[model samples]
Target: MAEAAGCPLSVIVPALDEAAGIAATLEPLQVWRERGAEVLVVDGGSGDGTPEAAAPGADRVLGGARGRAPQMNAGAAAAGGRVLLFLHADTRPPEDGDRALLTALEGGRHWGRFDVRLTGASRLTLLGLVGAMMNLRSRLTGIATGDQALFVTRAAFRAVGGFPEQPLMEDIALSRLLKKHCGRPACLRERALTSSRRWEDRGILRTIGLMWALRLRYWLGADPAVLAARYHRG
Candidate 1:
């Protein structure tokens, strides 16, 4: 596939049964494609035809084993850009996101993530607060989540040995490694809009508590396999 002119960013989206949102997720990426960005959708055995959904919008659609980490790694391996962006299927970047990424890299920022806004009709103040806290915590801790649309230069990604092949917390593991080796992330101000469907379906309070508890256990040396199971159960 031909890349858009002057842009060298390759967006990697890992998918597993994400058919519902894949098209919407890839639609906005068309603008980036116009500017030389390539979109690669790495689907992990999605029986729901996610690859078909993404194929029309994405530059390339590749199949892989069923796991986010591994699927992401596969995309990274096939990507032909100087930079890599790992985006969730339920997230969409800001209007000028391509420019923002190029500008950040031009300004010597190696790796970073966009702030995220939860989108939905839930007028729950808690959701807003949660987003605020997430942005703040990420800025303070220099950690970026998949929902935040994490981006890194190819060199930096290789230096960090890529995302870990874990079921849960791959984003966290990548963030920690990036901080240790590349310093704090750029923490872009422009926000990516992420679907609030998860919070809407699962009780918001319950989801937050569960996430925090999982992180605590992970930090305390819990096995990722166990954590993954817990996450599935939740």
Candidate 2:
């Protein structure tokens, strides 16, 4: 499907202290540019030279407030495209993922995410299991996280008031809002590769348990700030 509107698509990446991973995250976009998409990287108080490393391939780089949500919103504000793709600094889309995203956007799926894969082979089985679970959940409930490389039309994003400027779970919050406004979400066939650093650090099962517990608490109407604090403390 091709967009009836002729405006370009913009891929926005929000980064923080991602010097080690930013280049890998951006390499796919360099190929996307050849297919006529714009790429923007928004840095949030990165002490490392992430901005510089990402600048060479990015169409524009903006420095912004130190939070992923705000940084993404800033990038969206600066974007000239009608379709906005919000990617994490540690995630990489597939080679033809931009085209696939455009197709989804044009097919009237205003907001959606790709399937996810964890990079590297260490503990690959465990990470793959988690990815399978997430895929199943997304297929059943249309809920996806940012690490899966979510995309939406600019109008849909603005209609949902953009991403909430929170310290944590901004992606989940935004996904909920999008589902409320858009009715149903969609998923691309291609998978986005995300770093397994967090799982590696916290242990996959332990982290998954903590995440489920936090989700249960949130569903029980726990305060976002409290949950964010707990996440930070962990």
Best by lDDT: 1
Model 2 C-alpha RMSD to native = 3.0
What TM-score against the true fold does each predicted structure earn? 0.95, 0.93
Per-residue lDDT, model 1, residue 118, is 93
- Expressed as tens digits, the lDDT of each residue in 41-117 for candidate 2 is 99988888989988887988899998888999998998878788899988889889878888877787888889888
| TM-score attained by model 1 | 0.95
Per-residue alpha-carbon lDDT of candidate 1 for residues 58-77, written as tens digits (9 for 90 to 100): 98999988899999999998
Predicted structure 1: lDDT: 0.89
For candidate 2, the per-residue lDDT at 48 reads 88
